[model samples]
Target: MGRLKVRLILAFLSLILLPIGVTGSLLQLQSSELEEKERSYRDSMNELESTIKRELTQTSVSDLELNALVNQYAAEINIKDAEGETVFTSYKDPEAAPHNEAIVDSSTLFHVQAEDGRILFVELSSQLPFTDTILRSILISVGSGLIALILLIIGWTWYISRTILSPLKEIYAATEEVKEGNLDYPIQYRRKDEIGKFIRGFNTMRTHLKQSQEKEEQFKEDRKQLIANISHDLRTPLSSIKGYVEGLQDGVAQTDEMQEKYFRVIRQKTDQLDHLIEDLFQFSKLDLRQLPLDQQFVDSRVFFQSLLDDAVEDGKSKNVCIDVPRQIPSVTLSLDPVRITQVMNNLTENAVRYGADSIVISTRIDHDESNFTISVKDNGEGMEKEELTKIFSRFYRAEKSRSRESGGTGLGLAIVKSIIEQHGGSLWADSELNYGSTITFTLPFLKKELV
Candidate 1:
């Protein structure tokens, strides 16, 4: 910034000095030429005076004739003899003359036999007025130089302010716009200077920040929608539980079997509410504070085997089949065992509620050793493509009221999504209507990938 100002100042000074320097050089040349002219004219006058002397001595001209000849010959000087008298002058009538005094020339004293015996008088008059004219010319040269210098500097200052400062003003205004939360403006510049670099950097930052802001806003909107859907789902089930329990308590459900069924429905509602509360707490921790996962190295193969065993024990009385791929890796992976178990249960439960009588638990360690991917593909009535679009939204239930009837809080996929993202992995759902839905999640390995 300071450098640009310095350059501008330098340009201004140069503009001011350029004309003055040229004017000074030309004035010096003119003065030298004036001196040469004076010397040439002075030399010609001396030669002419010598010829006049020779003619007067050789031809023996009369005084009147000589005076008339001298008068005719004189350019601006008067010629006279001894006693300091005007013998010949351009003006004969002394009273009606242009001058306030008479001419005084005493060069003829050289011809007289004086005591000193030498010419004491000079022939030429003093050129004080002509010298004054030369001095005036010099003054004019210096004055013009100053005027031109000032005019040029002023003109340059104006041009620079308009062309340079005007654009800079725009840059400043755009900068203020960014400060006020608008990072959508374009920076216009072509100069290969530091300001151009600044504009480019600013534009880069604006683009990045704009993207981040958009993501944040989208996430907020999704969260809001999720909360609304969850509340709606919970309200319907809660209302059903409330109505049935009240009926039983009021003896409206007179049969023992009817009372028992109403109590079971209340219990299911309580479990659903508890699960939703827990999901909400965990989601908050993962999304807002980025809490560290309580992780440990556990053999993933054995872990899935244990999950399969628990599923068998729980579903032995029900019509269900749980499957774990035998080719699952035996590698020790790091993760929060409890949270991962919760995720597995959530995915399995989602399948159990919406899947067919058969559910598959699959795991594979691909050539990409950077992460472990697990998929729980269900054979139940699958969802449409539109459901896949919002499968990870919190509290978004595809089956509507049926989701609450199936003990679903609609946050299983949403929580899985958050945890995967927190672990620097990814989760996604692929499904075909009435075919099946595959809920897949990845857990990143601690080390970077190897070729």
Candidate 2:
């Protein structure tokens, strides 16, 4: 299974099995050595019996003297005559049997038939030295095995703790760094295991958190720029209104026609102020996702034709000839027509203000089955590539100057982008510095598959 599972399994198995195996091995060694000692002791007893029988039959030695010879074997001697009379005993207590003492395991009984037709009984008993030696060997072997097992347990514990603790320590350190807001630091573990996967997930989380923080900062910056632009833009129109009002009060317009003309200019400036305020409010609503779409089904051909006809009239009236596509593909679209119209109006207004003598509205079907692309192209002073990237950003102007020629409150393109994106479409601009600019956007069709 996993590395952690395997390590734990092995550790527990060793804990259960190692001591049992060591104990069994030492017990078997002790038993084998004891058996060998028993065999040697039995052989020595047989040899001593043969020597005693031969000495009593051939040498005719008395039991007391024979007992003196038994001392050489470190054995106790007991003798009895055929008449059942006690003859001699090497034991300190004449009535005591050697087998009744601690040397019972070493006691051996022998019967001898002498040539004089007499029967004799002899008992020999001694503590075997090999028994004590074997006992000591067993104790030492058991103690050594227990010590070896303890060391093995200690070593195993160290290995298991290191294997588990090291990774845990690394993870803990990484989390502490994240808590301190250092998301840029990365862990360098690359094992293909659970811990590795966990580390990778943590790294991914850190990256996303860092990105979210950056977006928040950028949002704050955009809000600040919006406030600054609004103040500057409102100052211009309010200044004009103040100047015109003061001029009228001071009788600068003496004639009725002049007075009427001054009032008309004031009205025009007031209208401009109203439109600026409305656009700013709309952009804010769109940015905050407060504006919801009221989508309608409209024939693409009719929609484009009507929109183009209005643009052509406005463009011609202003001495700028705008071109409309003669043919538009017959496709039904699901869209918010009011918002799309506002986007086109903003783009067309930009074209006219920026010295475009000719403008064209065109369409292209996207490779996808659901959506079609529309572009507003103008032969205006196009922007640099770097400027193109920031054109759709709120309060960003490539010209870097607040002027009437640059059009509305600098939120027009940004609003257009938000509107198109809200409708599940995309918007972008293509421009060459000296050639021209095209603002393109996608509109989805009414097909159910498109949704």
Candidate 3:
């Protein structure tokens, strides 16, 4: 049996057996007392009978003397002659009165031959110590108490079943549902007891499990898409390179200019392939948390100056003007310089690839002085607001055709977001369709050493 069932059974037994044990003890005590009183009454009656017998033997006992003896003993006396006629009784009218059977059965009797040659029979009454009336009252009291006890046990059993056992059964059924992979099932108990808390906790756990399963399924779908994108991207460049090599072997490019153009196209395709592979490698490291950050405190102004110089140099080829704030914040920033440089490079390259003519880099410190914010705004054909949220997701390209033409692997912003977050920072973008876009990020400020 279950522990609770066993406990309830033991409790019921205690309720029943305890009262019975006590009642038995009380009844035994009352019985002993009753026996003692009966024995004493019998002894007194025997003494009275013996005295009367002796007195009759010594001298002829007068009726008045017998009456006096009966009065002294507080008993009833009956005296009969030898022929059983004309007996003297303590009752005033012996023929009109009948003796009680219980009193007669408990009475003492003796015979004595009188001096007149007649046998005298005398009987003395004995008072019973325990009566039928008292016995009946005791039985009624014990019976009522037992009935009340039974009612109490019944109510207790019902309470246990409703509050404890019922909920436990529901929990068991819920577990069975969970074992069958049904996470949507929930317990419907509403009380605020421990059992209710447990039920609520179970429901919460099921909800989390459901969410996790959904995320896992989504991740699987994203992985499939990633594989498809990688295959398509890899095949395009390899096919171009293979076509160019075959053309050279077949002498399809007869002139020097045509062969030079074919070789240049092949090198460009190879470069695209190299860039795609490098992005894949970087994204894989970031996703797996294998990319380590060499975080250090660096002066913000010096870092931005170097970053802007590199961006300006790279933007010159695309005719993109790289603009920066004349005054950079003089705070010390905590970041990985190499990773932050990669972030800037990716952002500026995205701007140049997306028809940006001018790229502006701005910096500001938060009012609380806890962190620094930087924004890279560009005059490019911006994206819709809906695309902003998904730009940081791997393999998510807002403009697939434009991305292919620009040789974009779609992991640039994703990598940048990862690097920023790993440095205890956040990144977001604000863009308006047909307008310009601004990509903003934050980095924590290095704490000042106490003097």
Pairs that clash in candidate 3: none
TM-score of 1: 0.59
Span of ten consecutive residues with least summed lDDT in model 2: 95-104
Candidate 1 Cα deviation (angstroms), residue 170: 3.4
TM-scores for every predicted model: 0.59, 0.66, 0.64
- The runs of at least 3 residues in candidate 1 whose Cα sits more than 4 Å from the true structure, single-residue gaps closed, are 1-167, 172-183, 188-227, 290-292, 311-318, 366-369, 381-389, 446-451
How far in Å is the alpha carbon of 369 misplaced in model 3? 7.1
| Candidate 1 local lDDT, 171-196, one digit each (tens) | 88888988999988877877656666
In candidate 3, what are the lDDT values of residues 243-323, reduced to their tens digit? Answer: 999999999999999999999999999899988998989977976889889988889888988888878887887788998
**Model 2 spans with C-alpha error above 4 angstroms:** 1-7, 14-164, 186-205, 402-407, 446-451
Misplaced by over 4 Å in model 3 are: 1-159, 186-212, 250-259, 449-451
lDDT of each: 0.68, 0.77, 0.81
* Candidate 2: tens digits of C-alpha lDDT, residues 119-171: 78887775565545566767876786687778878987787666667777877
